[model samples]
Target: MTWPLQRLTAPDPATYSPRQQAIHDQIASGPRGGVRGPLAVWLHRPELAARAQDLGRYCRYDSSLDQRLSELAILVTGRVFGSEYEWQIHKGHALKAGLEPAIIEAIRCNRRPDFADVETEVVHDVAFAAHRTRDLDDALYARAREVLGEQRLVDLVGLLGYYTLISLTINIFRVPPLDGGAAELSDV
Candidate 1:
């Protein structure tokens, strides 16, 4: 409620150029199954839309991290940014992906989640440390390396970076969840 931004109206499909339409099609028909959120905003620039969605596809699906970890990271990003739309969409995905409800609640409340799994704990620590301090301390870095291993560690960092952009976009555009639900980050 504090930083409510002016929301942009989605561009009419009829107004889309060939490139925009093509990119829209790519997004609408791809793994995401719809042109929504940041991709919807980026559609005004077809190339940006195309590239963003592609990167998003990789980050969301093809990354080395499993879907559970990925959703956890994304939920952290959404909570950190206080992005309503981001949190609203990913919260269910996080739960469905098998992230514990308690962990989700902790993140939603902006408190340290009590993760039963070290991987979840590591991800939360790494992401919170990175976002809050803008860098992971050596101890946390080593821990992440140990817990996540090299490739997943790399993917974790990538997921954080990409989701930062996503959070920024959602916040800047004041994108509401499709459901027009109440704000999830109100307490935070």
Candidate 2:
């Protein structure tokens, strides 16, 4: 499939403003190791980059949800937005976080994955519902709260919100996957 050329370019490090350089340095030194994709695009506004990256670091690294479950929610957000960059980047993360490959494939293909546990199922359902409806029904809310607990439930929502911001940035900026890979998601 034909992909649009990226609409924005990250500033060269040599050209970065003092603030930009600081944020870039901080991001590169952290678990993310570098600024790329949407984060790179955000460098155009260093304040946004700094603030968003801080929140992103929390969502990705310090969230109360387990990594596997967090990845599940991120994948759901990526799929919902048809953000190939987001999907391609997080697919590896999902796998590394021990999310089942079959479930990842199912999400990629827009199929319902047969989750092996209730918590996984609840995470998937909450992610799906959060994107599709933007609000949870009473039953799902109660189930999520019960299974995920209050802190995790809140963190899960924050993770979903952060990834949604990511997806929008990637899509709006026409960010390409690493190495200009083929699209991982097609209309389903």
Candidate 3:
């Protein structure tokens, strides 16, 4: 499905309302280099924009899970939800963060991905648990606790919840793939 809104022009800070201008400035410094579609829409809804920005900052920089593991959880959630937009966007970040290409492919297929170590296992376990049950069970909870510690395990769950929200929003909005990009499911 195509995205519903017109493709946004590169945001000019000077053209924004005061609140949106601040958001635009923050987006300039965000990880993806510029604010794209979901954010461009949120700019008109400041509270939601702020919430999204907070989620982005937390997931990308402040989450206790290492980047690779964090991304694995995200990919797994996207795959489970069949969110093409989320899977496509996060796959590149996951790869750049050192998730193996083979494992990323496996994630796209909704299989158990092979991981290099126990840290990766923790990510897969928590994601599988969350996706299947909408909550962790005793065995999965124990494993997560043993591997991630209380704080990081909590953060991991938060990250999964955050990304799942993002996936739902993007899918419901029919947020288009980045301009000129091939559709993710097409290749798969």
Judging by TM-score against the true structure, name the best candidate.
2
Model 1: runs farther than 4 Å from truth? 1-5
lDDT string, candidate 1, 105-135, tens digits: 9899988987788998998898888888999
- Rank list by TM-score: 2, 1, 3
User: In candidate 3, residue 24 scores what lDDT?
Assistant: 73
lDDT of candidates 1 onward, in order = 0.86, 0.93, 0.78
- TM-score versus the correct structure, for each prediction: 0.95, 0.97, 0.85
Clashing pairs in 1: none
RMSD of 3: 3.0
Report residue 134 deviation for candidate 1 (angstroms). Answer: 1.1
Those runs of model 2 whose alpha carbons end farther than 4 Å from true positions after fitting are: none
Model 2 quality (TM-score): 0.97
- For residue 25, give model 2's deviation from the true position in Å: 0.7
CA displacement after TM-score superposition, residue 47 of candidate 2 (Å): 0.5
Cα misplacement distance, residue 51 of candidate 1 (Å): 0.9
Task: List the RMSD of every prediction in angstroms.
Answer: 1.7, 1.0, 3.0
Q: Which candidate number has the best lDDT?
A: 2
- lDDT by residue (tens digit), candidate 2, 1-188: 77798889898888999999999999999999888999999999999999999999999999888899999999999999999989999999999999999999999999999988999999999999999999999999999999989999999999999999999999888998988888889755
Please say which candidate is ahead in TM-score: 1 or 2: 2
